[model samples]
Target: MAPPAWTTRPNAKDDLRERARELRRQHRSVPEVAAELGIAKSTAYRWVRDIPLDVDARKALFAREHSSTTGHGQMMAEARWSEYRAERDARQAERVTGAAGSVGGLTQEELVRIGAMMYWCEGAKAKPWNSTRRITFVNSDAGLILVFLAFLRAVGVEQSTIDFRVQIHETADADAAVRWWAAKVGADRTIFRRTSLKRHNPKTVRYNTGADYHGCLIVSVRRSRAIYDMVEGLVIGVVRAAGRPSAPCDPWPQ
Candidate 1:
């Protein structure tokens, strides 16, 4: 005898509901439960949606299933950051060590040459008509300034020849700059002409306070040739010191 059609179809609604309930109780994901039971994920979700579970119960279930995931992700990120930091630290250490090594090798002649260039380029003011030879430098950076004055003493520019030293600067704190330079170089302030003060305006974009301002001293020599020769020699000396062999010639050899 053939079985009844209703029996053969096998009523699945009750079975599906019971399975969904069991899955939710066991803390299995809805998608995982659906896949195991051969049903649509939406259908599995709908089966369990009407059931009430407390927030604490849901939180406990989530913690049990995915506790290791957070730790694993954090460890991966930390490992990557550690590698980057180590590489950065190594490069910085190499630079510091290399700089120290170079400094120990510098000769007295090289030091004097460095002082001369520093004065010419960084300390001195350039006039439009006269080249850097007619330029004037302030005794600002104490170490370099001392070295430069020693070089000047060696070259024999006498006290009388060091005539009419003055400072040309903006009106704000011009006097302070002059005083600072005079004290540093052991020169008489009486020999200094009055500070050349420039007019200031509110609309001026020059926000420079000139606080680090050591105003330049105009060391007017009797013969310009000696000053010019010193400046030219400084350029050639600096190039050689840097290990770049450059042909010695005055850039403006007049």
Candidate 2:
């Protein structure tokens, strides 16, 4: 005689019931067990409701609930994230390309304004207590350093007037860094000053110790007092033009 209909059904299948119980011990939800085993959710619950989840299963369940990721759900989560990142990257690239196209080229006046703004943010400033006027621009970004050099050239600073120095950790390849800066600046190595070596602290973890790490280039303009006041004036002008009615250039009018 053939097996009864109830015995043939998935809910009543011994193998699926055993599998459902195993998944339940792993903290699989009733819906998940039902969908996976091709059984009704009520049946799945009835089969494994008494199986208590262990600590690992509880943690896995928590991870799955919080981020849609964990033991069994990790592959699905990764696929979803990969798809999301690709879409986001495409959108960002399109917008950035359009915006970059809108900027035709930098004019002399625009370069001056931009250079002054850049200096105001990165260059050293004079204080009343120190009163030493110097033009020292330091940066680790090669592009920014090149732009600053171009700005100096635009402001009538000769290549001979600029001095370059590499400040780096003692563990870094100082000679290689010097060569890199020299090539980037297109200046003779003779013009470069002594490299400053920073003592490496063993206890601290460093992320900048790779082959691409060239440390920082310090550009000190010799006899720069002439253009110091001009940069200051430009920064002051920008600060004062924030709203209607310009204020006097006096930084401390109190």
Candidate 3:
């Protein structure tokens, strides 16, 4: 092919075209080869436009360039994902820490009120037909059990008066659970009643397996008729107080 009008020397123009042809054989694009050889892209294209690249060479070139761009995209995506996870974790930590700190400086009166509310929710209540009101508190959380024990202690219920038992799935470690509970409540393991096992159902899949799965503890107060009455009265008082209407708000300006 004839070189551009700017090139008057035939030998130098032939050398340029030869060099451009070698670059194209090595899978370089026309524009890239032209830029490197200090020639116009149009001249480079005209020189090698009819020269077909081998199928293998074309595929290899595409793979090489595609791999580079794909690697860059992967790195960019990974960096963004890491940044998002870090931001989310920091935000969650801040919220959790703030919430934990806000509950600090709780007075005895406040704890008592909170305990009563917890009892109202979780403790056994007296039904109209079955009027056997007892101080039976069942829970899976050790912290809650400890808190309830504290409330009982504050209200003058001795450790000897409280009965302990474990209610767990038949698949769990009942002995270990009972021992753990006894230690937590500052009671003897021998004092704990026999472990209550819920028969395993083959049809159901249970998630409460592993080391963290210590079954629910049943805390029953011995001869707690008076204590039960007090708890019921306290709950009744709270309900009545909550039901009362608040003072009316003043009307807004027209």
Q: TM-score per candidate, in order?
A: 0.44, 0.71, 0.63
**Tens-digit per-residue lDDT, 1-254, candidate 1:** 99888876857688778988898777666765787888998988888776655788668656744467667435645787899999999999999999878776556566557656765676444568645555345543556656666656555666666554545446567667667767877887777766656566767776446567555555555565666577667777676756644545435435
Model 2, poorest ten-residue lDDT window? 243-252
lDDT-based ranking: 2, 3, 1
1 or 2: which has the higher TM-score? Answer: 2
Candidate topping TM-score = 2
Model 2 residue 83 lDDT score: 100
lDDT score at residue 237, model 2, on the 0-100 scale: 80
User: Which candidate model has the greater lDDT, 2 or 3?
Assistant: 2
lDDT of 2: 0.86
lDDT against the true structure, each candidate: 0.65, 0.86, 0.85
Preferred candidate (TM-score higher): 2 or 3: 2
Tens digits of lDDT, candidate 3, 1-254:
98877677468889999998888988887766887999998999999887777888788766654576568535645787899999999999999999989986767776676777889899998899989878999999999999998888877898888889999999989899988888888888999998999999989998989998999999999999998888878778777776666524444567
After superposition, the stretches of candidate 1 with alpha carbons farther than 4 Å from their true spots are: 1-108, 119-135, 138-144, 163-170, 210-216, 237-254
User: Which structure among the candidates has the greatest lDDT?
Assistant: 2
RMSD vs true structure, all candidates: 16.1, 8.9, 12.5
Residue 240 shift from truth in candidate 2, angstroms: 1.8
Q: List, residue by residue over 49-75, the lDDT tens digit for candidate 2.
A: 898777888786667755643445666
